[model samples]
Target: MAEIKTSVTINATQEKVWDVISDIDNEPKFWKGTKEVRNISKNGNQISREITIAFRDQKCLQDVTIVPKETIKAVFTEGVIVGEKILTLKDMENSCELEALWDVKLSGKMGMFTGIIKKHIKSGTEQALQAIKEEVEN
Candidate 1:
């Protein structure tokens, strides 16, 4: 398992930041590689979506666990990869600090290239955080 942690400080209220981060529908706007989000199924607090990532012509279940205004954790509950994404928001009075912690653990042949996988994921995390910061601050 490879852990990747990234964070950005946005000049926005915690609630405002939370409003944007908690909405799965808002992801496509900020996530560059996320092409589309569809087939949303909500089971009480757990929510899952079939997402089209990039131009792969494929989709996977992105199961989410939310903690109201505090955190949003997502994982590939079923798909080619296995990992967890935990996004947390800290109220910094004047500004909010948003952090993302990602863990990737794949099986079979893909598992051998954990270093390459983690590098790509870390880049994505940085990009996503920067996008979120720009969206919230602007």
Candidate 2:
């Protein structure tokens, strides 16, 4: 598994940040790479959803698992490659920090090209964290 982790601190209270992060539907608004997210099923904090992520001209379908105020994990159940993303939030003295950790295992033709694509995924996750920071700070 290849892992990428990125974090950013927001000058907002944990609760304030959580309010935005916890709402899975609002992801596209903050994460530019995400084109859309539709909830497939939900039972309290546990949720299953389909996410459409647009990178350049490619739109990929991902199966996502969300645990409110805690973790959000998404995997490419179908698409060019198989991969997973994990986002977590933590409180830190008058501010909140959001961390994005991604572990991806490429399969099929994509697996043969995983080395070239890994950097893009890492950079994208970093950009997503930056967007989240800006949203929470502003």
Question: Which structure among the candidates has the greatest TM-score?
Answer: 1
What local distance difference test score does each model get?
Answer: 0.82, 0.74
**lDDT per residue (tens digit) for residues 1-138 in model 1:** 999998999999998899899887778787766778885888876888888766344466788889998989889776555788899999997998999998866545767877776777788879999998988888
TM-score for candidate 1: 0.89
Worst 10 residues of 1 by lDDT: 52-61
Candidate number of the best lDDT: 1
The clash number for model 2 is 0
lDDT of 2 by residue, 1-107 (tens): 57778888888987777788777788887776678887777766556666676644444556667776777877777666577888888888988788988787566
